[model samples]
Target: MRRLLLVTCSALGLLALLPVNGALAVELPVRKAGLWEMKVLSGGSVPEMTMQQCTDETTDKDMSTAMSPVAKEICSKQDIQKTATGYVTDSVCGVAGMTIKSKAEINGDFNSAYTVKTSSHTEGGMGGAPRDSSSTIEAKWIGACKSDQKPGDIMMPGGMKMNINDMQKLKALIPKQPAK
Candidate 1:
């Protein structure tokens, strides 16, 4: 359960990371307010996952406001540059005693659809050995959220819907591990 929460938190961190250069932090453009479906593809131990998110501008901005400070505190290097193809971000951050160096290229406009390809190498981390991974995240605007859903609500895999802001509720969703 702890591991799952850690993974969740890490994923949230990645979603909001932006370039920080000597206090000149550039805010990433907010996604269109509504429902967005995201599919993550990877060849690592983790399998492909899909989720839908209901978001508003303020919720998205709040995530950035809440996370950037933590990123700046732990990351010695974080850079982003605009490219002809799209935008590219490079970062080196430490979490849970592991150092992660990554480069990601983002393509497509956020209003409709977008793709982000990321490659990273991790050292001295959870597995206790160096590891490399690559992943692609494709997301698209999926219309409005159901009346029952609220902003920051994410329909995670397995059809569990939880608000990103109420993280404590996530503990109930993670399955327990067997006795080792």
Candidate 2:
């Protein structure tokens, strides 16, 4: 009878461990390559020149000129949250800011997560000119082993451009295994 009880308890313990092992076995899907779009909604004045000024200015002919102070200020003040969603197949996957190196797969049907980084440097303005500055921003999607493709060209709304290969590499570092 004691032997029977011991065997039963051992069986129960192994049965309990099965679910745990199954849970640990879950694999994350891979990311793929495709087109991704993102938008920034900011609070502040929209930069625009009056019609009269446009007619008078000969040097500044482009409508999409450099960002004005008000525009910059607004962009700085507003919180920026970017959400990326798209499809992935064996041939292609599309996400904003990164090139799909390889196709993403649905390992266990969980959505991937991402991280973003941004930096800017501004030179103090001189002689009433707007401060000279530039910014570099990168966004990385983290989770699972997906695409082998590195992040590549990113397109902004109204046709802006950025490079995000490095960021994608960083995101690729996310471990495929779950914690024990």
What are the per-model numbers of colliding residue pairs?
A: 0, 16
- The lDDT, on a scale of 0 to 1, for candidate 1 is 0.71
Error of 2 at 60 (Å): 37
State in Å the error of residue 81, model 1: 1.0
Q: What is the lDDT of candidate 2?
A: 0.23
CA-only RMSD, every prediction: 6.4, 26.8
- Per-model TM against the reference: 0.80, 0.20
Q: Using TM-score as the measure, which candidate wins?
A: 1
